[model samples]
Target: EQVKVSKQNFLLGRGERLTDDIVIKGGGGPKEPPYTFGEARRRLSPMVSETSSRIDELPQAACPGDEAVISLTINPEYVAKSFFPHELMRDVGIEVIGSRPKKTVPEKRSRGREPSEVFTTELFARGRRAAIRNWSQQLPDWRSDRGSANALISIEEISAPVPHAKIKGSLPEQGRMALETVLHASELEFSMIQAFAAYLESQGIEADLGHSFFAKGLCFLELDAPVERADDIALFTGVRTLRQMPSLRILRPTVRSADIPTTDLELPTEGPVSEDVRVAIFDGGVPENHALTQWTSRLELPGMLPATEGFLSHGVGVTSAALFGHIDTKVPLPRPYANIDHYRVLDEAPGQDPHKLYEILGRIEGVLSSQEYDFINLSLGPCLPIEDDDVHAWTAVLDDRLSRVSTLAMIAVGNGGEGDSILGLDRVQVPSDCVNALAIGACDTPGKDWQRAPYSSKGPGRSPGLVKPDLVDFGGEFSRPFVVVAPDATPSLTTTGGTSFAAPSVLRLGTGIRAHFGSNLNHLAIRTLLVHTCEEGDQDHKENHKEIGWGRVARSLDDIILCDDDTVRVVYQGEISPAKYIRAAIPVPADPMSGMVTIKATICYKTQTDPHHPGNYTQAGLEVTFRPNDSKYSRNNQVHPNSASFFGSSLPGATEDELRRDAWKWENCLHAVQRKRGSSLINPCFDIHYNARLEGRNFAPPESLSYAMVVSIHAKGVADLYDQVVRQYATQIEPLRPVLEMPIRT
Candidate 1:
């Protein structure tokens, strides 16, 4: 359906005629790509047996005598039957373990189409000699003619037998295994740890539990056992042997402390603060007597020890940056844009218990559920880098919580990016991999000559390479650090540099947007605005692209949302139902003398996550298309000839297919077409279509899945397009006014 465009008279004094035949193509063309029997059979071959005779011809290794953990690939068509895999496993005496959508390399044919996807679930079963063999024998009979009562495609072992000699090298010398285990949230009360402990005791083994975490369907356990008993635990609790094996083990993490340099710069004792926007800072404890304490409400969660001098620096620095704008001792300190609510969750004592770090997840959940805040800043994150195959509990929990709650969480991408080490590059620390969080990396000040801070992390990010550090901000550069108030009564200041400081800078911007927009703006809208305003300078510097995603975000909210005389900016915030599209029409300048018009659009949305499936973590994605009013591109046309040329010109000679693959179909955020004339032989309007899809999932998305889109049109070297559009579509376009600051009360 067409979005209503308000009608208003435009005073077109210039001798330029308006195009009368403006048309909008209604719906997207059929999305399904034609499938062939040969292709389907080839794709299904790895998982499906043709007949009972074929099952008998399987390799001998497929029928192991003892129990094993195996991965079963199921057809996408059969996934809707919720009871299919469970019942089949029960019938076969196999236990269903953790499951994730199988990651398939996108084929050329898969481009521009939402292809049907498949899933692979890890399963544990014993008596494979009997159960699997029997099932294979009866497969032909169960599928008489054309019945699929059984959804089992193919099963392959996931666990490999470790040689007894090599097992010693794999286990710790002290018999301690710092594991990061995952337990189903629903089964937390079942106490799998106790069960495993009992099993170990029966085998004459002794162990000690180090650290454990339980929150919202996730459990992380750390165990210390005798070195000799490691094999038994590995064999018994293996995903192949039992379903209770840890999802991942914390093997030799490269943890480094943030290098905080101290300075004698003194901070102002008082500054202006606004209560209109409330921000929660989750980091090391903020000292109550600190100079910024007057503007901050500090609370220490249960089990948090009193802040020590060393621990106070990181949290205080982060909190100060968040409350007050980036600290520049060269100028008068800027007043805080929002009231602060700080939650202390980190303790950095030497040789502190590792368990405390793991437990921070629960305390964070407590604060998020119990407290109310518009924005949450997590300047503290584990130094461990995330794996492509696994999603850490910290990342999963934050993504789940933030998407459900109204609050937006900004996370630091860690300070591990220093040094010439290969591990330091493109490695975003845990939780920073969180797709929902606004992960920020550090860049040097004066973003125009923007350089990623030597210590700022980079990313191809978690699996499938979703962009991390969604954007960058001026944190501080080498030799020159951001200065902030120290946690001392003397009003002393300190210098620090890291993504930790970078995150709060975004927080400052967020609070400003919230304060200006009031309650009308949502997190997705705020995120859209931030990313939409990001200025990626000098596209020729391709090396810096990944290090500084999208480039540094514009510091001023007014600069992002408000338009100059030649440009008209329109923001759309609403929800789109699953598998549906929403269309908005843009009124082109009526003055044919409008010269060259550039249209840039950005779309951002938050999706419910399936952490187990990091490969397809975002369950929902928005597909957007901008169709200019040109007769050359008809409603039924598959390719827009003008679109190809426009993209080729704007994207530096990119092919039509490459442009379609990168900007239009692949990414969730689409920004394209910067310089096309308004008076070119075409229709007088452009249509923006948003289509939301439930990617790689069997079910539909929830009813209220929100999304925000920002579309701005600029008339280069011509009349004021903003006034013209405002005069023409007064009801449809509402200009965002700059926030007027009230007099500060000291």
Candidate 2:
């Protein structure tokens, strides 16, 4: 077919032909003759112009491939004038303002060719460098592919504004058309934006652009002007989809500030002596140079070893409180007890192997065997809501091994704060969370009052629950009296708050109790002794509640285990007053099968020699006990056994209704006292219990032969004190009293 070659058919960069027949022809105009260089004057000679021409008169032959090469040159001034078309510039919201004079390049010529040449140049910009390069790579492929069917195009560079002058590539054919389309769209969007900006600016409002993926399809017009102006513009725009630009958050370094007041809680009487009593503080080890080193004189500690790291300082602080607590006015901290031992685990690696805990147990056991330590204080732990199987296995091992050991272990409930998670009171934290461990909770310090440290982890153990934080003690706080270092000294001290501090205080009390009450101490007995010696308070007294573990803490060693003859007589000491009636539970023995026993009572007080010491006398007193009967004794003359029965009945003879009546009777007594004295008393009850081991189904090992006897004295009077009474007798009373195989007839 003889295809008519149309002048309008334009060839693409890639070998492709466009069918569009739209080409402009040059008009044939008057011609001028070529001037001879020798005939013309030099000034009048035409400037030498470079042009491509065939060297031979023969017509140009076709090359193999279907591609055409065209030559062209652009005036630098023309490109500078339209550098960034107004439409494209407005998209970025930058004004063209003006441009610098164009620098012209000398005209060039190639042998038998025109001066123009095509080459690719890379584009880049700071921050936007990646985006520009990415765009550039896509250009050639995109232009060639699309231009094959549209307008063929090429890219170029031009001078730019700001940060040195440089321009990106441009398109000559199809590319130019595509770029123009983009520019046109940007111009339309910018026009709307400018009109809105001007409207806002006139009302004293300014707007800026911000990215917002969540704005859906809507564009973000940030309120940069002012809050009121921005709000006005936003409301005025009727653009409900607009959102305020997020503000950048400011972050600044933090510096801790602390101020501690001097305390005068020291007693004139020398500290009650405690010797080679090994009390192991399980926590971060104290650096010898610490300000708290001064109190080393008072602690009954073993060799110091490191605990876990990261949060190790907490353990260090606890150790200081437990083993080396001494307060001095000018010195801030007085000399510490030189003999105390310390075990540290300052490595704070998370999820540490708990076997280390077992090793620590072994160390405590060694100390116990050597008769070096009387008690061990464990202030570090991996507290838990419920014991993990692994933890239970270890605990069972600890209970078995420790049940036979003599040293006392006092563990701290963690300081996870009273959060609903790990440390919540409902979740008893561990080693303190361990069944046999004497878990300690934090109390207000200085006056040694009851108030949970804000951070103390609390708990309601296993369902139906077991009591936790077996005891409470002063942790530390500004409101409480504590000895701390002055801020401006070469070495300074400050009061810190945490359960870490409280564990030590209770340890001191336990060690002091152990020292006062001679050897043969069992876990139950020690637990009982501490529980019996506590000074009880209301919910306001301790962190969680009155039921938070044991709601008492020992204030004086004599409160429990008073030296009487060959026996150390124990007591459950509590606050007593005229405003409230006090009731106590004393242990008595009875056959669980028979379920019958009689309760006996006594009332007396130590005679007051001096009017000064109020503790020497008591107007209200009672000794209520359940005395067990020996099976061999004849009915009438049966001498009571000093143990209590915890089974068969909730209360042996009292009907539910009768029990209620008795409760009312106790209340009446309290009311009568309050009415007479014009103030009800907040009685701290001192209930007492005693025990003896016999051949029974629930036999414990020799070390655990004795059970705990719990004596509870309360303002409201006694209620179901049997379990605690049994624990007390099993732990405290039995360990102290001699056990005979059979009853003796005198």
Candidate 3:
């Protein structure tokens, strides 16, 4: 077999250190010798110039025939020659052939068909370490056949294909002895002395002191290097460290949504009844006088530095916009409602602490359990490595623990620009990384680049593949303050951009949808609506976009005012299973007994699958809704259901006050269910299940359901029958009931 020489196989240098080498044009392996030097000279004469009289100094063996292996390396200039073909000397007796990749190389040369590139580089937060002890040892014949001399190739540089800095030096006698001592004592492999010697040289320092070998890439129990050079070492060869990238320019606010200022649309000015719903803002604290609230209070983080400081005003700004942006001010914006119960977690002193955060999460749990909050928005995160199980596991624990109790725990994906924190196995931040947690990434409209904000973190997920951010919203500066605060306070609003800002806007929008629609609004359903009804763009083009996980979200404040309906429409496909349930909820206004009301519901859906792989299946559906007559009961049943209870529920009559008391029980139960708990009270029982058979197994296709319930009330005897008709038409629904039941099995 002819050894094929290819340009791609040729590498400039191995590892981090720069070095050079030359190659032998053609040669056969050991065990064969040419008849005489003169005979070899004659065979090589045509390939050499007359000045190359010393060519015969090296001997060549004859080809061993077509069945035998032949080894050779092409001249470096062979690249210049573009794989120039050459005729072999027939007398050599070897069958010269094109070279194949190592994987495709004949089995005999492989000794035992071992895999190539079977090496791992241990990545740290900053750098990576690779061990060459298990690397294949190059045989003497291998070098001679390749036309390389007797120098041993350093495995550190050439072992793996990745590029990095390398250090090389001779270890001190004492250092080498100490290294040997430590290695022997610790039952380690490789020459620790040599490794340390090289490391010192790479760091531009001298190590006269001895060191010991430790396991897992830690070669030193102690070192002789100077301590002052620590910064330099960390900057260069130390663990993976990173510098913040250059900051981006703040872009101007530009709205492109069809819902923005489209054909003067007037909403029911006095239609919405203040529910006094409390929602927590898990970001920077709220600012006093913020347009959302004329009245505000502060919460303290136990270990915070400044005692009274909040993370920042960013979170408060978001909440203010969401719950009460509709306040009257000299600089009047869209201040809709003033009802809000806010919790500030991020901007507290000494920065946000996860431990403290667990407490905050507990607080959210309490609020949710007490039925005091309509939702909670988390606009903050941590700057830690999250690509491993420990971090992800921790985040999972939080999500599992918190999500069950909170009405909505919205987390931000962080404003860490693309590729910023990707170093050292670092993944997206925690909380957002947690499963069941809704992570939100930011989007800028008429976005300067007409693209998603450059800073928004993206994900399919780093570790367990959590469906992060659930949805996106216009989180840019333009929607800030307005989307962030409730509609009662007055505060200075400024430019704020982040998934943090977007999160609140979506949260508020969700609340509004739920308020006018109903509390049964399933977030997944809203996410689907955003994906389907939001402004659409080139789908094929977004395949590579990381930030715009789905695409630009489409929101319609206008549509919400005009639309009058609610529902869960399931279009079944394939065999449905009983294992997975399709759960949905919508907001329902209080039912009014004094007047007539109207309610309309519908469900629309379709079966979909990958065009290329139809065997893989999924389902999608939609439901339009309308309610003209919603009864406002004096005693509203606002009971909070456990996570599982919410997933699949059976109802009983209870006033809103009673419901608040059960909220925590509901959340705790839900959390337990997520943890796979079993018990009659907490176990998931009622649900519309679907099975999406995957591979040879059937499973549930992803399911989503949304709900909205609206109710209008009127005083009795205040109007004529015809006038009463108009009033009743405005709000007419009494304890609305529209349900869907489906069974799917895997």
Best by the lDDT measure: 1
Candidate 3 local lDDT, residue 194: 50
What ranges in model 2 sit over 4 Å off? 1-272, 288-312, 324-338, 348-372, 387-394, 421-426, 445-449, 463-465, 477-491, 516-525, 539-547, 561-704, 708-746
The lDDT per prediction is 0.57, 0.34, 0.33
- Which prediction has the highest TM-score against the true structure? 1
**lDDT for position 169 in model 2:** 26
Each prediction's TM-score against the native? 0.76, 0.40, 0.40
The residue pairs that clash in candidate 1, if any, are 47-153, 69-240, 175-227, 185-217, 629-683
Off by over 4 Å in 1: 1-69, 73-133, 140-144, 149-173, 183-194, 209-218, 227-231, 236-273, 348-351, 419-426, 463-465, 591-594, 634-674, 680-695, 742-746
Q: How many angstroms is residue 163 displaced in model 3 relative to the true structure, after the best TM-score fit?
A: 26
Q: Could you give candidate 2's per-residue lDDT for residues 374-477 as a string of tens digits?
A: 56666654334332111222232333344445556676676654446632334545455444456777765545445566655565432111345667776655
Of models 1 and 2, which has the larger TM-score? 1
Task: Sort by TM-score, best first.
Answer: 1, 3, 2
Model 3: number of clashes? 129
Task: Please give, for residues 18-57, the per-residue lDDT of candidate 3 as tens digits.
Answer: 1112121223354222123233333323322221222122
- RMSD to native, candidate 1: 8.6
- The TM-score measured for candidate 1 stands at 0.76
